[model samples]
Target: MRKFLASIAVSLLITGCTFPGVHKIDIPQGNVVTQEMVDQLKPGMTRNQVRYIMGTPLVTDTFSPDRWDYIYSQQKGGEERTQKNLSLFFSDNSLQRISGDYRPGGAAQ
Candidate 1:
């Protein structure tokens, strides 16, 4: 009886010393624009056309209606964070230029 009780206590102590691993959920925020979407943009496309291709801009300034900013970010558990920003400049409601972290056709300018 004594040996059985001692064995049970030892088992309980070992189990108590062990810790269950924590689980973390992936967090994603803002517009998740892909490269393929940006590739579809053309210089003369209208605002509506740009919206159809890239969805609505994440950040739109009332003071700067000619500029649209698209941003994307994600953080996965125990992994490196990812982020991308794309800005479109317009003149007379037509897309004129693309800038920021991503550029179509591998162009840098």
Candidate 2:
């Protein structure tokens, strides 16, 4: 009887989540890179300074030591997932350029 009751309860919990009215909260993951943060970066800034302004990068490759990738993704309750990418390049421990969806001087692309 206990096993039967447990199975019934489990089924009800699963079905409850499948109900149409069930609400799903927005899910955001990874580095939340922002336009203002990217704009704060300037050529010739040291790697530590860049890290301070932009927060930690989401991706850093050992093979490509000079390149740092910042990635952001969001999934709304019932909508398709969206993503943004930012790549910052450094040479000689100083920032050299920026690339990807975000750029300085304006809103994200």
Candidate 3:
């Protein structure tokens, strides 16, 4: 009986103790970028102009010059389902190549 009581007291004490600290959390959800946005981009547009229209490209290919990659993905908590990704390439200050897991925004619709 005494041991059981001691255990209960210890449990209560542990539960009552609260550590003081601040924690910040980031929550992610499916933020899909529409294909229409990409279609609006035009050749001869400068880097700053492209960014102004399409925000910022997620990945910039370091191996090549005048090439940029844009990627977007979303996954719910924990599931092995495929995530969405988009890639775009630029050359001579214009969009040159685009390929990826997600659908590229087309010029029409």
Candidate 4:
């Protein structure tokens, strides 16, 4: 009876013990683009030039060659931490329009 109790206790302890693989992944946080970066862009800038100012676009329209979309999104649980979307349209190898938080209102472009 004592041996059976000891075996049961050992089994219980082994079952209760956590093995491994339990972990918490940390999400990185930061801003994607700055207002200064967008202000530096000019109307005559080419596709490569715009790419140099901003990082690689998040969404490159497969169906459209003249539109470039840059989106920065961060979500934690059920709350949106940050969501910024920037769209740049190009025509004839020149920047046509810039729309987003990074675009400057009074800047000559």
Measured by TM-score, the strongest candidate is: 2
Q: What is the RMSD of candidate 3?
A: 6.9
Off by over 4 Å in 1: 1-20, 106-109
Candidate 3 clashing pairs, residues 3+ apart or interchain: 35-105
Tens digits of per-residue lDDT for model 2, 1-109 = 9999999999998898778888989999999987888778889999999999988898999999999999999999968999999999999999999999987977644
Number of backbone collisions per candidate, in order? 0, 0, 1, 0
How far residue 19's Cα lies from its native spot in candidate 3, in Å, is 25
Q: What is the lDDT of residue 52 in candidate 3?
A: 80
* Weakest lDDT window of 10 consecutive positions for candidate 2: 100-109
lDDT (Cα, tens digit) per residue for candidate 3, span 1-109: 9999999989978866343443433334343456677666665677778778667766666777566665555443343444556666666677666666544455443
Residue lDDT tens for model 4, 1-109: 9999999999978866353543434353443776677878888789899999887787888899799887776665434467777889999989889887567544555
Worst 10 residues of 1 by lDDT: 16-25
Clashing pairs in 4: none
Q: Model 1, residue 101: what's the lDDT?
A: 84
lDDT of each: 0.88, 0.91, 0.62, 0.75
Q: What is the TM-score of each candidate against the true structure?
A: 0.75, 0.82, 0.52, 0.61
TM-score of 4: 0.61
> Mind sharing the TM-score for model 2?
0.82
lDDT-better candidate, 1 vs 2:
2
Candidate 4: residue 47 Cα off by (Å): 0.9
